[model samples]
Target: MQKVTLYTKLNCHLCQDVYMMLMELTLETPLEIDLVDITHAHNSHIRAKYTDRIPVLARPQSEVELEWPFTMADIRAFLSDPAPDS
Candidate 1:
């Protein structure tokens, strides 16, 4: 299974769209999604970094990230690539 983190914010249509894509992809792919709301005060640093890049999909413990405007094919490609050793 692939473990990933999705950085997002509330009321973001783009984020919602990505979430739906992830959910649909889960049906065929073994994915573990960790939804992180950058809006929370606890995630201030993350919020600052992703304020303009909501709905970013990233591999856990890896720097690889797929930003918004990505398609299902892109997601599949991203997941197909193995995460680099940390």
Candidate 2:
């Protein structure tokens, strides 16, 4: 299984859309996604880091993140390959 963190926020349409896309992708691909609400007070630093980059998907071990404007095909590629430093 590929484990990843999804940075998001409340009331964000894009974040919600990405969350659903991840869920749908799980039906076909093996993905363990951890949802993090960047708007939370405890995640101030995370919020600062991804404030303008919500709906970011991060592969923890490699520290690779795929920002928005991505597609299902892109996600498949991201899972199967090491992403360029981002």
Candidate 3:
């Protein structure tokens, strides 16, 4: 299964939207999502990397990122595309 990482923060409306969209997508797509809270890991370098980009979706193996304000079509396309070689 494809691995999806969501970099987000609590009480973020955009993050909430993304979460809902991801839940809906999970109903049909076969992707495993890992939700990370930047606030809880504030000192971590990963948190710094996505500080201003909460709600970002990343396919670590593919090094692909889908930032917030993304549409369902964008999510669908990302899921359909082949993961990039490591």
Candidate 4:
């Protein structure tokens, strides 16, 4: 299974749109998602790193990150990309 982490903040329209897209995608794609609100997170590192990019999707274990302004086709390609170690 693929692991996805979402960096988001409240009241961010882009973040909401990305979230909706991911949710809609789950209907046809099988992947687990973790939503993290970086704005108020206890870990300042994450907040600092993603404040400008609210809607970031990352595969932590693989160190792969996908920023916003992405289409469904982009997401599909991201998921299909081979893992770094593979």
Candidate 1 vs candidate 4: the TM-score winner is 1
Models ranked on lDDT: 1, 4, 3, 2
**Per-residue lDDT tens digits of candidate 1, residues 27-81?**
9978898999998838578989899887899988888999988998998999888
Please give the TM-score that candidate 2 achieves against the real structure: 0.85
Off by over 4 Å in 2: 82-86
For residues 4-70, could you state the per-residue lDDT of candidate 4 as single tens digits?
8889999989888888888888998788889999977999999999999868988867778999889
Q: Assess every candidate by TM-score.
A: 0.91, 0.85, 0.86, 0.89
Evaluate residue 13 in candidate 2 and report its C-alpha lDDT on the 0 to 100 scale.
Answer: 94
- Local accuracy of candidate 2 as per-residue lDDT tens digits, 1-86: 77878888889899888888889989997888889988884957887999998889888767778999898887778878855433
At residue 30, what lDDT does model 4 achieve?
88
Question: Can you list the residue pairs that collide in candidate 1?
Answer: none
Look at candidate 3 and tell me the lDDT of residue 10.
84
Which residue pairs overlap in candidate 3's backbone? Answer: none
Scanning candidate 2 in windows of ten residues, the lowest lDDT window is: 77-86
Question: Where in model 4 is the C-alpha error above 4 Å?
Answer: 84-86
CA lDDT, every model vs. true structure:
0.87, 0.84, 0.84, 0.84
lDDT of 2 at 12: 89
On TM-score, who's better, 1 or 2? 1
